[model samples]
Target: MTSKLTTGRAGIRRGAAAIATAGLAAASLVAVVPTPPASAGVGKAGASPQVPQSPPLPQSTQYSADGWKARPEQYDGMDIERDVPITMKDGVKLLADIQRPTRHGKVVPGRFPVLVQQTPYIKTVLSLPPINWALVKRGYVIVTVDVRGTGGSGGKWPVWGEPEHSDGKSVVEWAASHNRPWSDGRVGLFGISYGGINQLFTASQRPKGLKAIAPAVPMGDLYRDLVGKGGRGYLELAPAYLAAVSGLGILPNTNLLKDPATALKNIQEHWDAAAGNLKMIPEMIQGGDRAYDSAWYRERSPLTYVDRIQVPTLLMGGEFDAFQRGTPMLYQRLSAKGTPVQFINGPWSHAIAAIPAAGVSLPGVINEPPGVKLGELQLRWFDHYVRGVPDPALDRRNKQVTYFENGANQWRTARQWPPADVRYQKAYLSGQASKGRPGALGTPVSGTPDTVKWNLFSGLCSRSTFQWLLFGGEFGNGPQKIPCMTDNRYNDQSGLTYDLPVRGRPLRFTGPVNAHFTVSTKSRDSQLTVRLEDVGPDGSAIQLTAGWLSLSMRELERGRSVVRNGMVVQPWHPYTKASQKPMPKNKPVTVDVEIFPASWSVQPGHHLRLAVQTGDFPHLFPPFPQLKDSFGGDVKLWHDKTHPSWITLPTQPS
Candidate 1:
């Protein structure tokens, strides 16, 4: 069955918000914090938008870096310093807002360590959060800046380029040297998404006085994470992300907010101004020859310079995030270099991690999940690095890999990723695709070839991206509200599936899933997408994780590839213009697919199933549409001893 489109109120609201008018110059930066929030609520003057009241947050207690319990509301109120200017190496001035702890009007006397966050999403967006309040109460000065461009900050954003690196360094240095009364010269970086990306850029530069960084759900490689994963552009979400960035142009100017009323006025003005068009940014990026890793993508990606990062880093990822593969890769590289680092892979999605429901707060927005612990985690990391506080949980001398297992609903820790104790178990594919029984995965089955047909535009981004965008955060839809795969019956019947025998006991698969297939297609070029599912006795299929490969881009970088149990850990591909070549005519080729990493426990009575198809629509643009590509006919799959096809699961020993 084909996917249906739902353009309801959310879609209409998003459409209205994304359309920006022409020739609106960026707003001017005001040099002082607006007078304290007005005591009385006020309405808008003229047609401007009405000011929004501060969002309400439930009263809650949080743990300090050194493990102390304290409520954010009980802490000393903060002193606000807005639109402060910091000059960069190139003389560009970025605007920043500083919030420091205060007791009865005097800046808390002693010098304190500082926590910095830089974002393209106006700095004012974070001004009212208890998240910042908690940090300031813990005796840390919080400085939030508008990353160059987009927020009264000078200079163009360069879309995540060198400017981010240079500006971040300057900001860290500025926070260290300028806070004579309130800071002792040490600073740590933190933020989510673009904020996370900025931290990576700054840490790579190794700015002096920079203590450490905690980047959540960051983009490790732009091309791999967004534009193209396995050589195909992730069409739907990429454009939406670009549109979100463009919308920032119309957001209320944080530097100009004199009070909540004034801020609301500005917000309405901007929203009203964005009524005609706002697709320019995304169009420009996608309009280029984007089939491969173009220069624009490489320059913005942190994967190129991550090796230079030397500071202690805390990296976090959500199992369902659009960019989930990133943090794990960062963890692996950092650990390989013996750099102090910690990694947490939770069962959240991009929204859940970005706009957390608990412990964190965004102005006028509240979707917090009760009893959240990420704030505590962040506090511990900063305390260990900035304050030199001691805590076994954040100790660099100890193992620090942590993951949340979904089916089991439990957290597990390991010294290294994928937990070195995992052993690879193989399940071979066998069955007649046309005969109607789901293909079976058995122990080294010897059989003839089977064929399956797939149309590229069938599924909807695997339901992860849409879930995050429409919902406030990843968990916005709540448990049982949004599922990764819906029912899976139609999809499994439409494609090729190899079902494993029912399990007699529980099985925990804690790492990457690898698949090897020997096949040939009549089509000039074909893309292979592999999905892993947990099938219950009732035949319900739950998607675990998936991997993709572009047949033409399958030339592996032999020296860079690592092989274990005959499956490449990460099949390294050149994906360069010179390395692109069509598959041999009707000749069988062996291709390895490295599925995204996952942590899941399969219970007794459940069986594992593998599904292979040529495309997952509205997620990644199909290769056929761009190049007018199509398979010659039914794609042939070989499974005899001469050309055995199997999948290797990283299972933890029982």
Candidate 2:
């Protein structure tokens, strides 16, 4: 915290101030004493958070906990069979790499619980299943498959289309029945990102013998989570990811080596498939305005059919992840239904999701994001749910919710998300910009309206760039990490910034944030971008999380929004074309934008900031059709007695 090196968004993580918080223990939970305020950071007062790292992923690490490392590996080595083809109902062949424990370089004579990960990314690039030695050695069967029309698999990539849904059920049944020699009938699903999401699709089918799933960093709602989060399209990530996967789809799969003639035909099929998906790239932008939240996304998002999935589920999420909104939503829904579930959320972004992995280190390394190893935790989860091994760790009463509080730099356990102790507090927008400073956040007052040009590159150079862009083999630290993730001063300049008056008292908050604004626009529509940040004493500000909303989609689903302690803690929105409404030019419109959740503490010298913009691009932009409605024009922000614009933050007790 004392470094004051806030040049990059990924700058210093350690905090100089200290605050007391509680930590979760293996068998119990207790209060933790204050430590030096080296916190989760980026900005003026922090040194670069990037750190040197190498070696094993967390899934392969051994934990120091009592029963964690106690289970010895049943086998010494592993046997991997690549390009194992399984025929679907339509006669399309999907390729999978199967890994089993080996003894003396030979397959062990035993039936092991099967773990499956279906992905669109090339099968050779391992992440979701990680494909490390530690897992197979511990007496489990690991299966990684390239989804239809991708990798070595035959048929077209469904983009989570119809084929993709049924394909998961087929793959699960295939693993449980076709791989009988190594399978024990009991099966589980595990993977990160693409690999992670397919688990929801497959499990939702109520596939037989699929006992449990561990979907790490998966999106629950494709539309609200990533594609067009808060009614806006992901400008760079959607197309880039589609292109990356489609390009990989055409790679000469290893199947070409096994059968040259047949492989060539399939390779051509891959390109044919890629060509079909590539056409959707431009359509993504058009869909942003016209077809956003269309039937296409509803069919793909797991939220549409989550209730159908009854299996025990484990979710690992990043507070700064692209799917941060969806992760907790999934947890809340499942836990509400009294289903078996566990959610472990940390202070990492999309690419940095594994920062707490077994052998890695970055920020918030106190008790956890890792006290025991992440790999062992999964092992225990599956042991109880899938392998029929009774474990106390599986007890639902124990910390079902484990989260990392960044500024505190410690991982704590809770019975539920937003924990039961949370209370929402409102900070009204007040004052006006003077000199170089923007408006202030303080007690409600009838302040004169402020005007500024709509911001298109609102978060262009901030944490969000890192959160949505980086995918595989990415680290939160080091030179490879994007500088924007560490700082937000660049974007703050383009918007109307409001800072909570520095009260000289520490303030702690976590969970969802709702930014309510009363504004007038010259255009018929506008996009609202709100970022929740923590500003340092030296004027450097770092982004905690952000939210977006196209004005046309401002309508809220009031009955669906949650009210706790008399404040709408979490606002639900129907970002559908049918819900779209026209805004009157030069008239005030009430808009509630849901800020993605985060966990952090405002230290004594630091303050909280809410930066608001009229529009954002490269991060999220309206479709071409809606450009006329949202394209740049000055916006009027009103903070008056009749239209008191404010932000609601879920404050948590220390």
Query: How many residue pairs clash (N, CA or C atoms closer than 3 angstroms) in each of the candidate models, in the order given?
Result: 13, 22
lDDT (0 to 1) per candidate: 0.64, 0.69
Positional deviation of residue 79's Cα in model 2 after best superposition, in angstroms: 1.2
lDDT (Cα, tens digit) per residue for candidate 2, span 41-157: 111222322332111222323454434443665566666666777777788877777776666766666566778777666654441122334457677777777788887778988
Clashes of 1: 13
Residue 544 in model 1: lDDT: 79
Per-residue lDDT of candidate 1, residues 249-309 (tens digit): 4555755554455345444544443332244334433433455766767778887778899
Give the number of the best model, judged by lDDT.
2
Report the Cα lDDT for residue 531, model 2: 87
